[model samples]
Target: MNWVVFAIFAYIFLALQKGFGSLISLPEAFGGMAPSLLLIFGVYICLSARAYLALWAMLALGILTDLITTTNPSATIIGPASLGYLLAGFTIIQMRGLVFKESVFTLAILTFSAGVFAGLTTICFFKMRSFSWLTNDPIEGWDSATQMYRYFMMVLYTTVLSFPIGALLYRLSPLFRFHEKKSY
Candidate 1:
């Protein structure tokens, strides 16, 4: 996988995720969850890239996520999302051989599954941080149940959006150059 291409896509996806979040978000009555474009792209990377490349991509995506989603600008903690993406990427790499990576449906399913894993891991990291001696809270709301529900809803929304997006991305797979390095 080409790091330059990966970085370009990462920037574009992150921009879309943040720039279009309000437009892409569900109604307030429905938990107001926004589809995570980054997660979908990250899933694509994990499914297509070789194991080592996938790990690095996931880490980069995670760090990007951490940087952007920081609630408090004064104190930025960057490990939660980074670790979450790494773990999710690792899990997907382990199971990639069992899935049909080229299928859009497979991409949607894996996106949701990985989204759930990474999202929950991120929440847990923040929750643990809240309990620590840190002066500032990492996350705004400490309501675990509500946060979990919202996160799940966001993942579901992202999964729904992944079908068309994944198809397009898969069509552009050659440009990404992942086919040559794909793990058999």
Candidate 2:
């Protein structure tokens, strides 16, 4: 994938995530979860590109996402989001050959699973950070039950949103021309 094009898309998604993400919300019963558009996009790109390219892309995306979205005033620790995204990317890339990548159902499942993995990784990091003596900035409202519930809801919401986004990406794949055709 062209770095320029990827950067453009990254900026756009970041803007949407930062500016308009709150405006869109799930029902109150669902904890008003907003879908992670950036994660969805990252997963889509990871699934579409070669493993090597996807690794770098996911790393860049993850770092940018952490920089943009982190609520910590100190910005002390940076690896949680990046680590989560890398793990998710690696898992998807490893499983890529087993699934039909072009199928919306497959994409949704991949997105959902990846989202859960990323969410769990992030939660674990936060939990560790909260307990560590080195950090003054511990995660507030540290209820494991509530956090896990919210994470599950967010993953589900992200999965629901991924279908359309995946379809759009697949439709525009010809223009980007990132993925290579597989030979028999």
Best by lDDT: 1
Which pairs of residues collide in model 2?
A: none
Candidate 1 lDDT over residue span 1-184, tens digit each = 8778888989999999889988989998777878888889999999999899899999999998888775465676899889999999998998899999889998999998899889889888877766757644445655777778888898889999999999999988888887564468
**Candidate 2 ranges beyond 4 A from true positions:** 73-77, 132-137, 179-184
TM-score for each model: 0.90, 0.87
lDDT of 2 by residue, 1-184 (tens): 7667788888888888778767876677886667788888888788788789898888887787677755466554677778888999999999989998888888889888888888888778887766657565566666666767877898898898888888887887766568656468
Q: Which segments of candidate 1 are over 4 A away from where they belong? A: 132-140, 179-184
Clashing pairs in 1: none
Q: What is the overall TM-score of model 2 with all chains considered together?
A: 0.87
**How large an RMSD does model 1 have?**
3.0
- Backbone N/Cα/C clashes per model: 0, 0
